[model samples]
Target: MDSIPVDFQWLGGAAFAIAIAVLAAWSKVFGKKEGPPAPKVQEFYASGQLADMGPVKELVESVGLVMQQMVRTNIALEETSKGIHHLVQAYEKHLAEEQRDREIAEEVARQLKDKR
Candidate 1:
């Protein structure tokens, strides 16, 4: 009689199946619930708001443009004020020169009248 080698593959598969069934039963009895996040995770996320605001890129560009315009306007205002100040100074100098000329003419007329 020729001896055939025993195949233990079937026994191994049956044992693996039983072990998996036991684990499934244990998990159903004692494991955490399957659907939602844990309470701790939910609580941690509760303080955060989801930003559904439209288009971040456009928002940034608009804000940047506003700031740039404000800066340019400020600079223009400063330059305009400087120009006004220069004009005021020139007007004052012109007034002073006109007053001095009037005084000199008055003195010359007085001297001529005294000589006559």
Candidate 2:
């Protein structure tokens, strides 16, 4: 018995062609049948009743309120930072004045000791 070598490319092409032919025949025998017509958009709104957009309006108003709150919070934080900066400046000034007073007192003590 002699076995012939088969080329994979030719075999794949023949298999694909047979599969396509079978699918075509199957669809011709049991294809989808046409049903009733789909309803049109005009039919849904034929009674002149508009779609309710109350939820959309409420969402926009809520977003506006959140933005306003964010602005107010930013302003408050800026004021707080400014107040902290002023407090640090005042504390530095107080320390400088206290050092100057201590130096003046030390000079006076030195002068009195030298006179004695």
Candidate 3:
């Protein structure tokens, strides 16, 4: 017995197209509905204009003062680091000078002993 050959590529394309069409129809029927129009920015702010914001304002001012103090402290810390670096450099220079003096004294003693 001989059987007819089926075209699987055409069948697959038709199945994919039907799946996409069903998904589109389902989304249109069951997806979220549009919400109300958003309020305008000016209107939104105007609605809350009568609310008291004194505490919020004072808190912001206190934060500003703290930030200023932090900036000053950072500047002082940088200056301290610079001063420490200078002190380190000076100590190193003093040590180098002492080493050179010791070397010179040793060389002089060696020459005098050779001459004697």
Per-prediction TM-score to the true structure, in the order listed: 0.53, 0.52, 0.59
Task: Report the number of clashing residue pairs per model.
Answer: 0, 0, 0
Write the number of the candidate with greater TM-score, choosing between 1 and 3.
3
Residues 24-103 of candidate 2 have per-residue lDDT tens digits of 99999899787998985664257654465567779999999999999999999999999999999999999999999999
Order the numbered candidates by TM-score, best leading: 3, 1, 2
TM-score of 2: 0.52
RMSD of each: 15.3, 7.5, 8.0
lDDT of 3 at 2: 47
Which candidate wins on TM-score?
Answer: 3
- Which portions of model 1 miss their true places by more than 4 Å? 1-54
Best by lDDT: 3
In model 1, the Cα lDDT at residue 81 comes to 100
Error (Å) of candidate 1 at residue 25 is 35
The whole-model lDDT of each prediction reads 0.86, 0.89, 0.90
Q: What is the lDDT of residue 107 in candidate 1?
A: 100
The residue-by-residue lDDT of candidate 1 on 2-116, one tens digit each, is: 4433687777788999999999999989886679766664442365633443466679999999999999999999999999999999999999999999999999999999999
